[model samples]
Target chain A: MTTLQAPDTPFLALDVDRVDANIARLRQHLDLLGTPLRLHVKTAKSVDVAARAFGGGTGPITVSTLAEAEYFADAGWTDILYAVGLDPHKLPRAQALVERGVDLTMLLDSITQADALVQHCRTHGVTIPALIEIDCDGHRGGIRPDSADLIPIGRRLADAGCLRGVLDHAGESYFATTADDQRAAAGVERVTVLDAADRLRQADFACPVVSVGSTPTAHATAELTGVTEVRAGNFVFFDLVMAGIGVCRVADLALSVVVTVIGHHGNEGIFTDGGWMATSRDRGTAQQAVDQGYGLVADIDGVLIPDLLMVGASQEHGVLSIRPGSSRRLPHLPIGTRLRILPNHACATAAQHSRYLVHHGGSTDVVSQWPRHNGW
Target chain B: MTTLQAPDTPFLALDVDRVDANIARLRQHLDLLGTPLRLHVKTAKSVDVAARAFGGGTGPITVSTLAEAEYFADAGWTDILYAVGLDPHKLPRAQALVERGVDLTMLLDSITQADALVQHCRTHGVTIPALIEIDCDGHRGGIRPDSADLIPIGRRLADAGCLRGVLDHAGESYFATTADDQRAAAGVERVTVLDAADRLRQADFACPVVSVGSTPTAHATAELTGVTEVRAGNFVFFDLVMAGIGVCRVADLALSVVVTVIGHHGNEGIFTDGGWMATSRDRGTAQQAVDQGYGLVADIDGVLIPDLLMVGASQEHGVLSIRPGSSRRLPHLPIGTRLRILPNHACATAAQHSRYLVHHGGSTDVVSQWPRHNGW
Candidate 1:
């Protein structure tokens, strides 16, 4: 067995058992709703994790970038959906994937993109499947379900034989401070996307798939009556942000960065080699009730060091100190002491590393390595 | 010629001429003070940029990670300094670099680290050179120069034949709101590192190099009288943060992310493919007098898009909107229209990509592809 002590400091560590549990819980919840899971591969960006998500079969996975679509497609997961709004320049790449017998679906929320994609398909004599992004919570890209522009956009895509479904992400669910608030936001997400699909079908457009999710909404939504698929990525490694949203407990976080204590400052602060580069600058928990500064500091065994928070971070250094209003004295960790830090957002933090050091069943032993893809 | 329209959307573009001019201006300023510029390679982790910084000769460069040191060492940059404080677990990697005939110097700020190094050297019979970090500003690491602890730490390292120099970084200079404040911080940095070096020499320890710099101080400092070396990394690519500090004009920024307009939001917001994944989450300019949101919007020709800022970012989407109080209407950028965005911090933004699309002067033609090293 490979131990954590063997690798160099400041590398991402993944607990396989926690990951398995997190995935199982989400799968079970979605399965009970009769909605198939179209797992987003953006969070882990690793084939090993995606393989497990596929459950030993060819997958219907979603991707944020075409690079990820290419990676997972090459790995035999041919049914892929590129979730971000489509840019016309990427059509050639999308065409190449389609030519390879991969069922790659693109996303768009505007008539301008629809017309351009339609013209491209006409010029090339090849059809591309696309989804109309619906604005569920006003957090990001998407058209309002009731907007007068929504039906025309879908009609235009349907004329080009490219319209596939409707998708919405309740990203604002992450901002909800309580479980009730998250559930309410999830409720809003479901009705909004379903309304858009209903509007399209009423307009004589074929709307087959209705997709809605965000990690918070994925776990909080009470029903998936009209939704055919649920897409959530971050549950494979629940993070401090998920805990803040009341969706998962801190103990469920599977991802952390193993760092070494490099120095001490005046008995009030400890410095580690893990900084924004290793941990990322996503302060997702800042607006939560109990703000975990950068992340919650944990011992090597994954136990939270009480009251210790990464108060600040530079490029390559993290300042570990006692949280405000806490009377706990700083731990006297000597130089070279190894510790694991739970991140604010698993997706953001995991994107910083190229690979993960896997440990099985809460053990420090490194069971295997998993590589992740980055860049466009 | 490979133009901006040739590559996929959301890739890093580098203005080679601006990079050259920025480096030349800083080099000329330091050369007048008779201080050698040990360029920090952490900003643009590319051999192409480092070769230009080294003026076509072997480099005396500084790195924030050992991975960078190994990269440049393999590329023929022998004189290297790993600026982050030493962690014992990384010593073996450092030793491997030294054994391969690389002059790699480590950094430490505590006596505990000194004693550990002494024991490691005694056990292996190998001598490793190290620098004592001095705290010029209470921004991050290093012991205060005037503290009694400084002399003992230096003496212990000298006894182990590992004491090489003293180094400090006035990271607080970034918080300075005016040129006078930046100059004052730079002055303090110069004197503090010099004081530590003098104390070491008085205690019969050989303190050869005295290094200090931050991008703001590098351009604002009036003199480097007693300092042997000045290390500045971000000057190679000035950013919005430097512009906020009044060090460099916005025209001097050489790096930007080229992205395509994918959608429009309510006639006031435009969405692009570049997000925190492409631009990074370094909001260094947030505390400055003028807070450029995520980044300042620019055209493909590197011209500023007036009153436009990237107001918010998700994992793979950036919301470009008019800045608050700006009466300018949003530009009518159709889908597929390409634009560039100037980042807040060059170091943080540059670390997000695998390679740079280099363009000579402001030309859209691609001149070269420079690969960068990432991860530990």
Candidate 2:
């Protein structure tokens, strides 16, 4: 009903054609290395996009929350790797997913988690598989590859018949300013997980799968070698952060926040009916060279409004202005003019909305609605 | 079920006792000024909170989205104000609310919106009321008190029988560093709205109601002379941003994010199951004197964990560590240990969750779960 009607402003607009192109680009790159994508469903949690990403079929995917695992499982996605380090308290839900005939794999970097997983499986009468996380660049969670606890943690999982493989995510690679930096980060990620797998294998464990990726690293990495699959979520709808890192061009961003210009603020800028609540407070590009405040602005039809940016935001109000130091004049966008804001981080921005108003090609009208799964 | 079972970490926890106290504090202040509070439900967008906010009865409420307006209206709350600057595309839903017998008042600062409202009502046969926004402190939206267009804007709405009053929000007051500063901001806010309302009245427009507030100004204003009603939202669940501004103490914060220690990140910090995806990427306090990174860290019992802070966040991982330059040792929070993170901004952080795990006075165990209405 919201789709058939004029969409309430500040809704997420997803360009499906751009989604197809992005998927194909990643697929072609990974195909050359004979590595399949275990697409992470964290960004576009909608089963609609998940099906599209796999060429209209469900496939192996990575999830960050059990809610995602359960949602995807209900939608017929059987293989899921919960890539965040396992929290022992979530065992009941994880076991429930396993009981649903899902190949739900959890990730852990500690012996404490391995022991807890072992205990939970034994008590719940369910075998929930797990992957050991390797810290490729210390961007976030993971066990250092050289850590003495690695073997003991893997041994704990192996003894419990829950060890699936080893995985790594190059979180730091997102800050890469060049393809070379991304490739190097990817190389480190690959080597780190493979090394951990080798150590586990030498310790009489069959570490079958080797998973490693991040949106930037995935596109930059040249070879997979012993890796069975790669995982990524934010690549499907490229954003300004990816654009800032030189991973994708602004033209390649498929997702945007559609907002209506409610009023003008003097002659310098205008206010939109969208703000942090709609676009999210993810200033992912602030750390990059060219800080895209909130996001870059575009027309409803997806054409970039040169040098215009959403510079500030409150809860439900966005302030759009010409980029500081730019010679471009502020566009005369009257009240009711719909503007599309390309987000700084696609995953963060996409999470703000519960559904996507699907767009095809360059038309401003939404073709359909796709519900997004949110919350853990 | 989520309440009885050990919770999946990274859920929003709301303290009912704190909520009652916060509500009482604001109500007591407003009562002294003989002004009724038009509670802004934008902060706590749950009907349960809305009910508690009005002492278990529906009263006047302000909403930023039609979703909240519709949701609140369904719960038997009659008086409502859609506070965001009116987007013409949203007239259909607004009309639908009015059709349902909800006294919905929209906001506007431009003649464009006034003319559009007049045309929409004439075409659709629906009478919708509106308030002229006065720009106080140049914070966000609203028309200037002395602007020549103000009289015309009021005239258009007056001719259409849609004029209700004038409103202003001292948004800049949320950053006040002292009580005097907040008081000064509040005085400016009250005077601005009253001046604009007076101008409209002198022009023969019946500007009956005067609404003005922001959490800080509502608490600090010395008088509400000529102000019919005051509006404020964030005081219900005061956050670190409010604390930094000296509006309230940290003990007044009613909301916290409950997360589990998934793993340790060496001796310096621990990783939490919660992150920006759970807490939201609202670094509101970053602009304050003491930036509370993602948020302050607390134990499951709601006790502060001494100088500990959720210093950094990824999509699904939060890094909890002792504050930099502090001598306090980072306490050991082993895997499976639960912790609660007080947020930087309640409105932004609470929006990330779809429900609240209700608790009473220092208790970690949730008493019940209340659903939150989301999206436009």
Query: Clashes in model 1: which pairs?
Result: A2-A366
Q: What does DockQ give for each predicted structure?
A: 0.82, 0.87
Q: List the residue pairs that clash in candidate 2.
A: none
Give fnat for candidates 1, 2 and onward, in order: 0.77, 0.91
Error of 1 at A93 (Å): 0.7
Worst 10 residues of 1 chain B by lDDT: B50-59
Top candidate when judged by DockQ against the true structure: 2
lDDT of 1 by residue, B1-376 (tens): 8997799979999999999999899988888888888999899998899888767776789999999999998888899999999998888898889889999899999988888887788788888899999999788889998887888888889988999999999998988879999999999999999999999999888899898988889888988998988889988998998998789999999999998888888887899999899998888888888889999998888788899999999889999999999999998888788999999999889888999999977689998999999887
lDDT of 2 by residue, A1-376 (tens): 3331267778899999999899999999999999999998999998999888887999999998889999999989898999999988888888888887998899999888999999998887789889999998888888888899999998888888999999999988988899999999999999999999899999999999899989999999998999999998788999999999888999999999999999988987799999999999999889989999999998887888999999999999999999999998889999998889999999999999999989886676678889999999
How would you class the docking of model 2?
high
lDDT of 1 by residue, A1-376 (tens): 7798778889999998898899899988888888888889899998898777667566788899999999887887788999999999999999999999899899999888889889999999999999999998778999999998898899899998999999999988988878898889999999999999999999999999898888889898889999989999999999998898789999999999999999888887999999999998888888788899999998888888999999999889999999999999999888899999999999999999999999975589998899999989
Question: In angstroms, how far off is B230's CA in candidate 2?
Answer: 0.4
How far does residue B272 in candidate 1 sit from its true spot (Å)? 0.7
Query: Model 2 over residues B1-376: C-alpha lDDT tens digits?
Result: 3441276778899998999899999999999999999999999998898888776889999999999999999999989999999998889999999999999999999999999999999999989999999999877999899988899999999998999999999988987899999999999999999999989999999998899988999999979989999998898999999999888899999999989888887887799889999999999899889989999988887898889999999889999988989998989778888888999999999999999989887665678788989888
- Which parts of model 2 have CA positions greater than 4 angstroms off? A1-5, B1-5
- Interface RMSD values, listed in order for every candidate: 0.9, 0.8
